[model samples]
Each structure stands twice: as C-alpha cells, then as structure tokens.
Target: MVCKLPAVFLLVPGIFLACTSLKPVQQLSEEARRGLGHFHKLGYNYAETCTMDCTFQKVRTFTVDRRLNCECASYQKADSVVWGLFRAMEQYWMGLSELASPGLTSYDLSAPVQSLHASEFVSLSEGEVSAIQKMAEFAVNTSTGRFRSRRILHYMKDADPHLRLLTEKLGFVLEQNLLGLLEIQQEEWYTHYKTQTINSELNAMEKEWATEKHYQLVEDAEKIRLKVVSLVAMLDLIAEKHHSLAVTAEKIGSENFRNITAALSDELKDLYVVFEQVNE
Candidate 1:
C-alpha cells in the first residue's frame, strides 16, 4: 500500500489557496474605504457652501430692506454691508465650485469622488460602475448650477414685484436642485444595497473574502446622499424664509415682522448644523 501524506501537508495548500483567493478582495476593500472617505469629504464641502449661501441670502435680504427704507447715511451703511457680504459669498461659492485658487480652498471641491477605477474591483458589474459614474457627474453639475443660481440672485433688485419674481425663481431652482439629489438617492442601486450591514457571523478570513465592491460603493454613496438631503432640507427652509421676509419688508418694524425674523434666524441655525455634522 502507498503511504498517505500527513494532515499538515494537506492543510498548507488549503491555507495558501484561501489567502490567494482573498488577496484581490482585500485590495478592493482598502481602495473602496479610501474612496468613500473622499466622497464624504466632498459632500462636506458642498454642505458648507450651501450653508454659507443660505445665511448670506437671509442677511442680504435684511440689509437690502434696510437700505431701501433708511435715510441716506443709514442707507449707505446698509449698502456697504450688503456689498461686502455679496462679495464674500460669491468668492466662497467660486472656491467651492473649484473655480477659485486651490491654495486658498482647504478642500478639493472641484471634482466628484472617483470610485470606478480601482483595479482590484475589476469584477464589479458594468451597471454598478455606471451608476456610480452617473452619481458623480450629477454632484458636479449640481454644484455648478447652485453657484450660477446664486450669481443670478446677486444682480436682482431687492424691491417690489421684481424681488417677488426673483424669489420665486430662486425657490424653483432650489426645488429642482433638491429633486435632482433625491433622484440619485432613490436610484435602485442605492436603495437596494443601502440596508446591508457587515455580517457578524463571518470569520475574519470569510469577512475579507466576502467583501463586495458594489456594496461598499453603495454604502458610501448613501452617506453622501444623506448629507445632501439634509442640506437640501435646510436650503428649502431658507428659500421660504427669504420669500416671506421679502414680501413683508414694509412691516419691518412690526411685531409680526420681528417674529418672522426670529423664526428665520432659528432656521438659519439649523442650517449650520448640517455643515457642522459633516465636519465632525
């Protein structure tokens, strides 16, 4: 009879095969982790920009109302303040849109997070890769559109029927922006995989081996989407607040006007929370 090989001889090759099988998955997980981090950073930048813009819009309306009604000297003061705020907000948006000096902006807000090129993830389905690419492109275009919308508001007169029309237009643009973001969040791929959690029963080896690149991408995308949803909610609140403030400027000193301003200020604070959460 032939002699049988020892158990250790069989075990060595099994271990080697297991490690070899897991190598590509390990690389994919690491790459996906880094990419997801970058996506969060980009989403944070967008939130910050939106918060700044919303605050500026509110203050601008208040200052312009004061300028329209005050004596010459007071009007000059209000105008100066409005001008200063406008310039600051404009430059901030430009920086966020990646149109300003890179040395000045701390974050690279220019491009969308790139998730599709990880070589270890070569097994990722074409549909999954396409979905990520589409989301990235939507983010870039949305940022650009927001900046343009703000620019349009910069030149609009803060008086009368014109301001009403302007605020309406502004609100519409904001609504469209929010809707676009919601569409991405509602995409089948994002919704399908967002509920999946890491398996607790998976052993360390199995955990690494079973990691799916598509799941990682979907999770990261959902994080960005949630940040965006928060931001859009805040912006929508701001738009309504500004419209109300603009429409009621004639009663600026009335009790009702004061109450509206107080409410708007509280809402603005809520908007800041979105930015703070992302930074933290």
Candidate 2:
C-alpha cells in the first residue's frame, strides 16, 4: 500500500468553516490512498511526456514553415500529392544522412580472429550475423510502408517517368559523391597508417584492405541510408502537400474545421515548446 497526500478539495470545507450538520468525509483506506497516489504520479508522467512531444512537433512544423513555406503553399495550391511526396523524399534523405550511420556496419563477430583456422576464415562472425539480421528486419518493415510514393505517382505509371528517372539519377549521384568521399578517406588512411618497414607484399595487402573497406562502406551507405532517405523524403513531401490542400479546401467550405485545425496547431506549438526546452 502506498501513502497519498490529501487532495486540496478535501480541505476546502475546513478552510471555509462550513459548520453544516453533514457527517465527516469518509477516510480513504491506505491501499486506496496509495492507488490514488500512483494514479496521480502516472498521470503526471504522461502529461509531462505528452506535453513535451506536442511542443517538439509544433517547433518542427514551424521551423519547416519558416524555411519551406513557399514550397508548402505552392505545392498545396497545386493540390498534387506528388509534391508532398517529393518533399518527403528530400526529408527522408536528409534525415538518413543526418541521423543514421553513413558507411560503417555494426556487428559482433561470429568468433575471434584467433578462432579462424590458419587457412580458413569467418567473413561474417556471429556479431555480424546479428547486425545484418537487424538491419534487414528494419529495412523490410519500415521502407515499403513509409517510403513508397504510390499516392504521388497514382495510376499514371506510363506518363510518370519521375520515379524511374530520379531513381537512376540519385543512384549515380550518391555513388559518385558519397562513395568518392569514402575512397578519399581510405587513401588518407593508407598514407597515414602503413608502416615504412612493411614488405612490398604486406604493403599491397594493406592497400587492398583499405580499398575493400572503403567499397563496403560506400555500398552499405547507399543500401541502408541513401536509398531509405530518398524514398522517405519523397513520400513525406507528397503527403504533406496533400494535407495542406485538404486543409485549405475544408477551410473554404466550412470555417469550423478550420478553426479546430488552427487550435490543434496551437496546441502542437505548445508541444514543440517542450522539445525546445529539451534541446536547449
């Protein structure tokens, strides 16, 4: 059983000196009081988290507005979900680049290097297997659901060269730019790490190792981060633009929904304030 403080309301009559003939208020049992206390605590915790989340959402929305209002408004006016999808694609790519690992893989080796035979090798150890499994599971679950831009393209598969054309463009651009960065990093590593006394064979092996690692990084970045980002951004943009249009249209038809939306947005801002507090 938990102890609980009496509610302020329970003391109101005493403070007011209401000398009525009514019986004294019923006393709460220890168990009940404890339960009430726990309930209050839980409520407080939820309120705190909820307030913070709302604040963050508002701040995020506002920041986007400040920077991309023109795009938002224009895309909304066009009433094409595709614009929002495109924006989502951009956002997704940006998020991946900013938030996720670029080139390195996380894994626990299947076994120590010592465990490998003198002639045999374990390319992917146990740790590596787990990491690969996790990565694959994450991709399969989130990518198609969140990243696909079906709504943007709609049924115009024939006329919409946007998907295929952009896919190729993005692939090539990322491969050259980001992959090139990986290559340069590798070359620098070799120049700095290889020992001067190493034999020609060892030197060659070191160089090869550097190149292989660089290649793997580039490949992983493209597969995991770049691809996901591009698709997610496009989809997000599409939905956002469409949502704006719907809001605008509803506003023109009925003012009530518009006001409600406005109020909701205000509450959202309050929530964003929570995030600002955390970030600061």
Candidate 3:
C-alpha cells in the first residue's frame, strides 16, 4: 500500500495520516487496527477453506447430513464466532484511537462508544480487568464536556491487556485449527495424487493432470501457511509493544515512549511491505 500498511487497513480513509504526529498510544492502537484487520481477513478465508476442503475430500461416501455434521457445521460456527471476536476487537481499537487522539479535545464528544464487554473466547487476567475498568471510569469522567489532559496512560493501559488477550487467542486459532486443517488437506492432496500417478487404470495424460492439480494445491496451501505464520509473528510483536507502552504509561510523551512507538510503527510498516511483496 502507498502508506506501507496492509491493504485491509488502507481501505479506511485516514486512520494513519502519515503527516500528522500522533501520540504514542494513538499510534500503537492504529498499528494494531491494521494488524487485526489483515489477520482477520486471512482467518476468515482459512476457516472456509478448511471446511470446504474437508467436505470435498470425503465427497464420495458421506451423506449430505453426515458431511455437514462431520466437516462444515463446526467450522461454520467457528467462523461466525471468530468474526464476532474480530469485529469487537476492531471497534475497541478504533474507540481507543479516538479516545486518545489529541485533536479530539473540545470536539463535540458524546459517548461515541457502547459498553464494551469482555468476550467469552478469552479470559483476562485480574490486572487486565482492573486496567480496563480504570480506563472506563476515566472515560465516564471525561464525557462531561472536554477531556482536560492529553496523557493517554489510562486508555493505553486499558488497551494493553485486551490487546494481548485478543491477539493471543486469535493466533492460537490460526496456528492450531486453521493452519492444521490446511496442512492436512495439502498432505491428502499429495498422497492421493501420488497414488493416482501409479494407478494402472490411468493413462499418462491422466497422471500428468493429477500431478498438475496436486502442485496447485500445494502452492495454494503454502501461501496460506506463509500468511498464517506471518500474522502470528505480527500478533506477538504488537502485544509486546503494547505491553511496553502500558509499562511506560506514566511517561507518555517521553523519549523512551516515543522511541518504542516509532520503532513499532516502522517494524509494522516494514512487515506490511514484506507481506505485499510475498502476496504479489
């Protein structure tokens, strides 16, 4: 993308205005917004691919109901749940970004937020719960007319735990369930086609065709695997950076905090560049 964020993130008009100097907390939240968007899209596709491949792999034997039960239904439900999780996470980050922004001061601010809740998919630490609650209490106070301070400590601190919880669980799902399913499908393709290559009933052209299809499956699965691996790494990076910001919450505009956020945004941008190159 022109801004070195994922295409998913760039689709939003001005979340990361390169010309504007955003506070450390605002910058971090926006970076995370990009990361979550890109990963969520990949996860959505992975879920569908997993279910579809599993269904067709056993197409010759299972009844429609059996196929749905064995393959499609669980992943379909998982997909819906995952979508909800990502949607909530995205909104949380966007709200935080708005909450922490400098330009939002004295703006016509009503409660631009709903009551945010913790999702069932993740169990937050006691520290996380306390932190978010503190932030929420602060937000309620600030809604009277205008936010009096620019110190983003409360909001960043609030975001620290939820960000970690959400990304950690999302990465786990991508690695354990979606990636695992795709790898299994890729292996099945290899084995099935390899066997067909030697089948006495198949002519040379038939074997060649099977080999080509097998290669296509491998190539496609490899792309998904690479993307999942990249996203998992990105999740870890963002969570760790957010934790650093939370720790430095008291020193919001200090050189240390500035350095941390600058390094993070650069790293994230570099990663997105690498991602685009790979995808192309």
Candidate 4:
C-alpha cells in the first residue's frame, strides 16, 4: 500500500499531486519490468525448440552436399530482435518507475551493451522506435554523476503512447513468433512420433515407446503455450492500464483517477499472483 502523503497536491504546479498518486503507477511499471527479466531464457528456448523444418534443412545439407551443417542458430536473428525489444521496453518502464518516484535517483547506462535492432517483423514506425530507444539514452544523460529529480508528469504523458505500443509489440512477438515456433515444434513431434508408431518394421515395444514420447511432448508443449499466453495477457493488461492512466492524466488525484487505479490495482495483483507460480 502507498502511504499517504499530505498536501503535495498544493505544490510544484500540481506536479506533486501527480507524484502523490505515482507510487502505484511505479509499482505497476516495476511489475512489468520483473516479468520480462527472464527474456534471455525465452530467447534461448525459441532457438532450441524443435522444428521439422530445421531437421529437413540439416538432413538435406548432409545428404545432398555431403556437408555436416548444423543450423544451430536458426532463430538467432529473431531471438536477437526480441532481445533488443525486451531491452528497450525494459528501459522505458524502469525509467518510468524511477521518474515517477517522490525522491531523486540516479543510474548509469552510459556503456550498457545491448542490441537494439529493429527488423521488418516489427511494425513500429522509425520515430516511435527511436522514442522508445531513447529511454536508455535518457538514463545515461540524467545519471551522469548527478542525482536527477523525479516527479515529471509531462514525461510520463509523452512516453505513455510509445510505451504502450512497445508493450503491444512484445506481446505480438511472443504470441506470434515464439508461440508459432512451439506450434511448429508440436507438429514436428506429431509427425516424427506417429511415423515411428505406424511403421510396420517397428516392434510393439518401439511403437509404444514412440507413442509415449509423443504424449510427453504434447504435454510439455501445452505447458509452454500456457506460460507464453499468460505473458501476452499480462502485456495486454499493462497496455490497458497505461492507456487508462494516460487518458486520465489531468485527473491525477481526482475521483476518476482513484477509481480507475483502484480497479487496476486489483487486476495487477491477480496477475502478479499468477506469475508467482511460474517465477520458479
């Protein structure tokens, strides 16, 4: 719970009123950041998930060209792009959480090594991408041996749209790209295992073993799908919450702001509970 601060609404040209309500917003943004911290693992899983296409390419190379070609990084570009998007979005939310606080803070990003590649797969405009990417640069500029002040309402208003778009794109990448990969993997598993089970040359024991493996694969794939889908839902919720906040910016501490935020807090808590189960 945010401890109430008295009468900040009277100070700083109505900005402190905004700050007084920001702890919840900051908490929301922090939750968003925590959810994506495991993106490296997500990217690795995307690369390694089995696919019949990958197998076919490898086999064709070895057979036709007499070459031992292991396309181990088949999804490396997609992984890198996802990594870049995650990093950029993380920076934005992290900055938002920091900038919305009541006190001053500083953090360095001057020499942060992160890929920020945008691809044709991303449907964002160059200007929108640039705006999100600058969040890191903003941190670098503000935190260069100086404790920068917070309580900026205009900054929040400015970033809200671009950040919402980023949240959306992240969901799209996860659902469409990663989930698509998993679907292909499941299909490949079905084809591979079913073929073995139906092969007349295979003994009953071998066919049974193949059938068992197929069932296992199906179960595992379902688990991954549920996890990824939950992430997509979380992203959608974040965007919705952010949109609500942005549109109600002028109402900072009004009844409208309080009502929307109160409802959103409950929604966030429910989603956070869901994430706690998978955080392990």
- Mark the 10 consecutive residues where model 1 has the least summed lDDT: 18-27
Expressed as tens digits, the lDDT of each residue in 1-280 for candidate 2 is 2333223333343344422210000011111122212212211121232333344345435554443212234323332333343343344333322322212222333353224312233344445445544444344333332222222123223223453444344434334543444345445444433432244556676767756754664454344333333333332233333244333432222354344334433443443343234333
Clash pairs, candidate 1, are none
- RMSD vs true structure, all candidates: 32.0, 32.6, 17.3, 16.6
Per-residue CA lDDT of candidate 4, range 1-280, in tens? Answer: 2332222222233222222345555665666666555454342355665434566546534556555344647566676777777788778778877765645333433233123223333344445445444554444434431222224446567777887888788888888888887787677778878888789999999999989988987876676666676666766776686677676664444576556656665766676555445544
Give residue 148's error in model 4 in angstroms.
10
lDDT of 3: 0.65
Q: 1-280, model 3: which lDDT tens digit per residue? A: 1222123332233322222234665777788888766764463355577666757666524546633644456667777766665677778778878866765643331232122223444344545544445444444434421232233566667777887888788778877887887777777777788998999999999999999988987887777777777777777787888788787664654678778877877887776765555576
Give the C-alpha miss distance for residue 267 in model 1, angstroms.
2.1
Q: Candidate 3: lDDT of 49?
A: 75
- Angstrom error at residue 37, model 3: 2.1
lDDT of 1 by residue, 10-80 (tens): 23433333111112212222322322222234333323333433443454355444332322454345434
- Model 2 stretches with alpha carbons more than 4 Å out: 1-155, 195-280
Give me the overall lDDT of model 1: 0.40
User: What is the lDDT for 189 in model 2?
Assistant: 41
Error of 2 at 27 (Å): 57
Rank the models by TM-score, top first. 3, 4, 1, 2
